[model samples]
Target: MSHPHGDSKRTVWYRTQFSSWMIAVGVVLAIALVVIAAINASYRTVSLVLLIAAAAFLVTGGIKVTVSAHGVTVASALVPFLRRTIPLDRIAHASARWTRPREIGGWGYRWKPGLSAVSLRQGDALWLELVRGTNFVITVDDAQTAADLVNRYLPGPGEGR
Candidate 1:
């Protein structure tokens, strides 16, 4: 099937496991447990709840990554609710980098010290550094494919470096 936003000449979509919504649910549950435990003055319960919260964060972080495509447009996906779009011309550079959990720091459409780290595991990414200095990154299942798309559409200076 063709994605609505993809170019006519190319149509292929790639979807990968970003993260389990269960982890978010788990955080909510753990927070509730902590509140309940605190109200009931149960130290053991509170401790257990905190542990669960940590586990949820870790598990969720591990699962979360990116979904990308080359010829296909990725307008509608798991994180579409929080996704942003940047024109190819505005992209400065894109590459795959190993980002640790604390590297990006925090979740959901964020930019920390390193770069715009999509909340996904280590994978190929298409990064767009805007001419205005701001940058955006999107995770993709295939690095070479994403790069090819950037080259085809954008085709600016310092490409294929």
Candidate 2:
């Protein structure tokens, strides 16, 4: 879809094997909790908690990254309440790079000192260097296309538009 600001929205979803494993584990744990609760009524509360955790795991099973004039937004598909959007104007540069989870401290969402990343797996990622010095990275396929779109949205040297 196109944004009112004259920019088209581009979105990509990345689902890792780890996420599938996590969802499976969560489902199994929730089922086990239910069985335990059936044996003893006192475990019902714990079972409810497990169910919630499982739902969270399912909801956040994949990462959705969008690039538009509004900026680059990284968020969970089912849960959009918690998201990070870096305005195009604030980005100094954007590029596609190969990165690893260890470099960013581990998977999921990570933040360490000058770098923040949604490090889903060890592969191509969109690297954004913001104007303030910190960098944001997102592990997604076709990182080059996303980087190019972000660069296109960025204002040029003397063109205020």
- Give the alpha carbon lDDT tens digit for every residue of 1-161 in model 2: 24324423443323222366656766787788789889889988888777877775655556778887688888876577767898877898899989988987787777899999887678988999999899999888878878877888788889763
40-154: candidate 1 lDDT, tens digit per residue: 7757566675775655453533322222332223332433443345544556555554444355554434566546655554445555555567655555456555555454555
Each prediction's Cα lDDT score? 0.49, 0.76
Best-matching candidate per TM-score? 2
TM-score of 2: 0.74
**Can you give the lDDT of residue 7 in candidate 1?**
71
Screening candidate 1 with a backbone cut-off below 3 angstroms (N, C-alpha, C), the clashing residue pairs are 18-64, 64-120, 65-120, 92-129
For all predictions, the C-alpha RMSD in Å is 7.0, 4.4
Give each model a TM-score: 0.50, 0.74
Off by over 4 Å in 2: 1-18, 37-56
* lDDT accuracy of residue 78 in candidate 2: 55
Clashing pairs in 2: none
